[model samples]
Target: MISLRKLAPALCLGVALQGTTAMAEEVLFYHDKGFWSEALAKVGDASEAATGVKIAESPYSSAEQYKAFVQSSIASGKAPEMFSWWGGQSLNDLVATGKIAPLDDVWKTAIDSGDFPASTADLFSVDGKPYGLPMHIGKWAVLFNKDIFAEVGVEAPATWADLEMVAEKLKAAGHTPFAATVQDGWRGFIWFQELLLRTNPDAYAKIHTGELAYDSDEIREVFQLWSELFAKGWFTDVRSNREIEDFAAGGAGMYLIGDWAIGLLESNNLPIVKMGAFVMPNVDASIPPAVIVEGSPIVFSTEAGQDEAYIKAAEYWMSADGANVWGAASGNSIGNVNAEAPNEILSSLDASINEMGASAVLRWWELVPAQLQGELVAEFNSFMLDPTMEQAEAVMANIQALNAEYWADQ
Candidate 1:
């Protein structure tokens, strides 16, 4: 059997769990808190019992923290045998390090065994080479309180005008129509991306890739509409961290969050029956409806010797059993064909994605080039905190400047 220690001499020793010895072959698995730690512990126990390979489970509190840890640890050859990550440009960084092994063979076997459909395998592929196993698919939409909408005499809006009308009614009824926050930086992109894509999906794509300027009229319109919401007092406090709680506590009429956040409400024993999710309204009636899609995946570490034990552990984690275990705990939809989303909202999202055609855009949070992600987040957050035409223009100008510099260097 190949030994990881011998393969990477500088690996951080603490990466190994407390009881693991140099001679004992154990596969370390790391992920963000989306997968409840206890559920992972159960999966690890089951994997070990069936394969006789120890699976050490480690989890970080959030995606940002997980990314930071992975970035620092990879330099020391301390990346786990397999770890969860976002696909697209986020995975590009690790792939560039020459420390992430391609999972083409694993994909082929998985498809052959009927564990995943050939089409599903494409989610984990980069440049036609599979590099990870998809763990969950999250759809971005507005999760609204049914009772609050009804109480305000407003149904879920189907068009931009309808949405504006509903927001007016909700505000008149003394309710914040939307729960919003800019403190996390990433949260600021949700509305901006949604509005831009709804306005013109193709233009949104072009703008992100630098084919269109960030300060273009189309982009500015998104800010104008978003500012209107803030101007009407239809939004919660700009930095409110209690969005989920506010939505659940009847303090906010709706929340524009990912489907994954349903797990948070469910775990907190929120009134699930009162909540319903809907794709945001199209800003232009002429444009097609679009929804943002995000994928969570697990990538194999090259430094972790790809021996029989490590391979088996990774395969088992990506298997139907493992997917089901994760779905049951995380309230996330598993990519495995045999596994289904644990809730109705996710099932509805899956069906919509199949029907939406060109309307499903890859999430901007991870789709943008890594070098410009932080800058874009900061720029967007700045506008969200102070939603004004001046602030919006300045933010877009700054983003365009950064965009030009980064692409020029590229």
Candidate 2:
């Protein structure tokens, strides 16, 4: 095994030390996070100890500002050594700028060593070259209140019919079957994607690539199911900011979100013992199981990748040891398959997903063409607030129009 620390000093060449003392050279890391600052700092400490390169973080509270700053910095040839970024079209755009470095070698190393699954590399790849390492790989599941399930005399559903039965029972017990919201705008697609995937996974994947029309029969069926759920009053107010809190307090029976939200639950003081997660059952049982997976990648600037020290540090960060340190600090699962899960709930969820042979579908927000994301999300938000058949029809038409315009331009 090659050691990063052994090669660090020679690779760091002209890099300045912290003081006159033999301190590790520091590299700037940019990310959009006001809440995870401390957690990231801890990860940085571990990186320095392992790689002989101090990882200094610069966090931004406003995502818009953070994106603008990063873009401008890259354009000015002053991009940070490393930065957190999204995958799919967003990453494609960054790679097209010729500023981001392709980390194919780093990816091959991790994949061959069994630290990460080869499928995960697809998330950060464009033209078959990966440009980043996974920061977080989130699996979407229905997080239910264990106490509420027990009170309703129900267990996690195994089939679509059982899911509806569980929901009806919870509703009868004066509990909302699920918590949902469109408050952040981007969240509107959560249920939309989940329901669509459960109903027609092929259509779900096809729609993102423009191979399936949004206004087709397959999509209409999804919207019809969504309307019926809303008509049954089984979901929380879409405008409410307390969706997670309501689920935590047992006011809502379940919340469908990425496992990364486990951190949010913990931050709100929700007891892990009260929480349980299950893969959303397939509405079309004939199809194989699937779960939405989202990834955040740490990308390197082209300039930074030229530095041997930065390359060594990136390699270290992709290893099981580095990923486990990050997982421990962030209270979330890292992409490394060899690393232990952050908590028992996540561990159980991972095992369940693997045991069932579920397919990992990318989340809609990142999977869809970037050009259409905002407009389509706005349409979804509108439909969530007015979940009528009429609104669903109109939203479908509007979304199809936007989708067509984007594909036409392409």
Best model per TM-score: 2
- Candidate 1 stretches greater than 4 Å from native: 1-26, 53-55, 61-65, 76-78, 352-358
**Top-lDDT candidate index:** 2
Please give the distance, in angstroms, between residue 248's alpha carbon in candidate 2 and its true position after superposition.
2.7
Which portions of model 2 show Cα errors greater than 4 Å?
A: 1-20, 62-65, 75-80, 108-114, 117-119
Please give, for residues 93-162, the per-residue lDDT of candidate 1 as tens digits.
7788888888877788888988788877676777788888776777888888888888878887778889
Supply the global lDDT for candidate 2: 0.83
Q: What is the C-alpha lDDT profile of model 2 across 73-160, one tens digit per residue?
A: 8899767678998887888988888888889888888999988889788888889888988878888999998989999899999999
Q: Please give me the total number of clashing residue pairs in predicted model 1.
A: 0
lDDT for residue 270 in candidate 2, whole number 0-100: 82
- State residue 228's C-alpha deviation in candidate 2, in Å: 1.5
Query: Could you tell me how far off, in angstroms, the CA of residue 380 lies in candidate 2 after the best superposition?
Result: 0.8
